[model samples]
Target: MKAFVVTLVALAVLGPQIARAEGGFKVEPSMLTDWKTVYGQVEAKDSIPARARLGGTLVELSVTEGDLVEAGQELGRVVDAKIAFQINAIDAQIAALESQMANAERELTRGEELKSRGVITTQQLDALRTQAEVVSQQLEAQRASRQVTEQQATEGAVLAPVAGRVLEVPVAKGAVVMAGESIATIAGGGFFLRLSVPERFAGTMKEGDAISIDTAAGEISGKLAKIYPLIEGGRVNADVEVADLNSEFVGARVLVKLPLAARDAILVPAEMVKTHSGLDFVIVATAQGPMERAVVPGPMTKVNGQPMMEILSGLTGGEEVLAHEH
Candidate 1:
């Protein structure tokens, strides 16, 4: 009878274990949620470097750094008074030549009339006509020189090429500048979020791709404007122009997030996945025992604001998994 009691106790203890193994394990279906890759940086859609076309000493600076300016607005002036003086001298020379040409024309007309009346020889008339022609040519040449000098004087006044706030003013009054050297920088019309993406993911990026920007102050929506053709330091640089950003976003640092298309897949908390060497896997409870399954993880998605990794392959729905160590 004692032996029979022992058998009964052993069966009772083993029955539940056998039942659990036969039924396997039950797990909740992985929830589907939106996912994105994020990056942070200060960005502007357009940056214009204002440079000088002619080298000269800066005589005046009208705008300071961060000042708002309009297209064609005079930003500063270079000391080109010498050019203006040269223009004035050329104008004076042109005026003198014009007077000389008028005198020669009058003399030529008189000489032609005298020749027609047989009062002067054809050679004298011809000489007077030739003189008038020479004077006309000289006048034209002087006018052209005056025009060139005037153009140089006009170019001395540096103007803003586009309407925007000046980001930097690198030169001060009395500073000597060279042609093509940047005097100031302006942030052009639109705002953009600058982000660097990993080269692997950057290959998927295209112009006009949608993105979201989150700043400490607020969130704004934007689209990818352009992807730089070359990669630097194993990363790709891209610009996302903000479509709905307000005035407050000026000069603010923002985080940009890019979302990819959705696919049918299982998602688990990143903490629930483990990595050994270069292999990625998860520990799932099975009917036999705890089994390690290899998994191909796609881009991570967010669930309840937590990172959830998508399982591209391996493992099925309703399987138990162990959380990764902290």
Candidate 2:
């Protein structure tokens, strides 16, 4: 009778534990939604070098590093004493040519009068007319030379080609510079986020596509400005011009999120999904027991601007999933 009672007690104790293990669900329901993919990098819209068109010693630098300058504003000047002196000399030559042309004109008039009265031969008149024409041509040539000299003098004054902050001033006052040498560097316009999309994703993106950039400062919206045709390192380069990044620093690192075609998906916290043996899965609580289901993950997305992962398959809405722990 005692043995029978012990047997009954063991059965009573084991049955509930087995039923609890099989029938009770341990996890809570996790809402699922679509997600987007993102990458991070430092980027800028454009960087242009300010070069000197004429070689000379830098005589004056009106702009300092980090100074904002407007397009066509003069930044500095090169020492152009030689060009000025040459211009002055050309003016003197032009004056001399003008005097010679006047004298030649007077001689031609005299010859014309003498020929009309038959005092001078037609040949002599013709020669005087030719001399006047030659002097006129010389004056024209001198004027042309003077114009060239003036243009060079103007070019000696360095000007900013675009409106932006000056990033660097490589040349200082009294520093000799050569033609085509960069005198300063400028970060034109405002900041932009540059992204390199994998070649596989190149066709999915286009100019004017909307993108979101997250920086240390804040999040900003931007549009794809350009997509390069050539592929390098299995990646395609693209530029994202930030329309609202007026206050952000140029070349600052930012996270860029790209949206794909819309589709229904189950969303979960990224950390909750784990990979094991090259397989991705999420632990879910079922009516029978805790279960690990295989899943395909899509790009991460934002929910109310919060980061979330898209579960492509395996889990359904209102299902309980264990929170992922580090």
Candidate 3:
């Protein structure tokens, strides 16, 4: 008992030197960001539907789901059999009008020759000119009508509105679709992360805030790009921009940690906390002696460029903790 008392006294005298040599940490409250863990979805910036311009049967489909396409690229062809028939009919009408126009021009030329020779009356020459003008106007009208029909035929080709991957192909080949009906849904304009957080955190969210994301490649940083004003279903929507984000799988959910607010927290040196039997412990020096107390440690952080561990419980401010040997 006497030797034990002497050993304790010696430790008390050398405690300061031991702490300085091993690197001691003071327990104090520091401000830390209060993070809220949530799931976010990888989404395309633009989700547009490729629609059919002309009502007809989809005769050819060049793309299906997960196919990449470019803007204005033909994805399918909508063939309206009636449109072809109409075009053929217009061609026939145009041919007939061209023949009539030729005949009218010949008669007008003959009339002019006769008038120059004083063989035809002025009234008769005027009649021939009038007939030729009527034929020319009719031909012009038929040509315009044919052009309109040809334009309708051109509309049968369904073109992609944007360059992106085809997400959904609603109509298959040989399926009849109406004008303005969606043929496939395309995702374009690059990729971003979409988040739906609780409305309670709306006021805390701000644009341009740094966000942490947990991805398959590991944790990555992102920025809070947008926050919507309208709230729905008690959730507030937001968009996060991440560089080099994996866009291979759109709509993939990823774990996210958002800094909602900041609060005071007690932190200690990470080396000071030791884990054993699935429970963490720290050494606290008191007048009696050094006592090993059970503690609940939170995530590791850094302070003043030094690694520190958050003490969730079993320690408080002004408590002297002994640093473990490295």
lDDT of 3 by residue, 99-203 (tens): 998998999999999999999999999999999899899889988998898898899998899999899998889999999999999999999999999999999
The backbone clash count of each candidate, in order, is 0, 7, 0
- Model 1 backbone overlap count: 0
Ranking by lDDT: 3, 2, 1
1 or 3, which is superior by lDDT? 3
Candidate 2 per-residue lDDT, tens place, 189-283, comes to: 66666677778877777688777777666877778788889999998878877776643355555578775444444566566679999999877
Prediction 2 global C-alpha lDDT: 0.70
The Cα error of candidate 3 at residue 177, in Å, is: 1.7
Which 10-residue span in candidate 1 carries the lowest summed lDDT?
1-10
Q: After superposition, how far is residue 69 of candidate 2 from its true place, in Å?
A: 1.3
| TM-scores for the candidates | 0.65, 0.65, 0.83
lDDT of candidate 1 over 1-326, digit per residue (tens)? 00000000112111111112232233333334333556656555567877877788898789887788898888888765577678778888988998999999899989988999999999999899999999999999998888887777677778888888888898898999887778788776766667788888776677886676776657666778888889999888888876666543356656677754433456666766788889998877667966788898877755445566767787566676654335
Pairs of residues at least 3 apart in sequence or in different chains that clash in candidate 2:
28-320, 32-267, 33-267, 35-300, 35-301, 36-300, 36-301
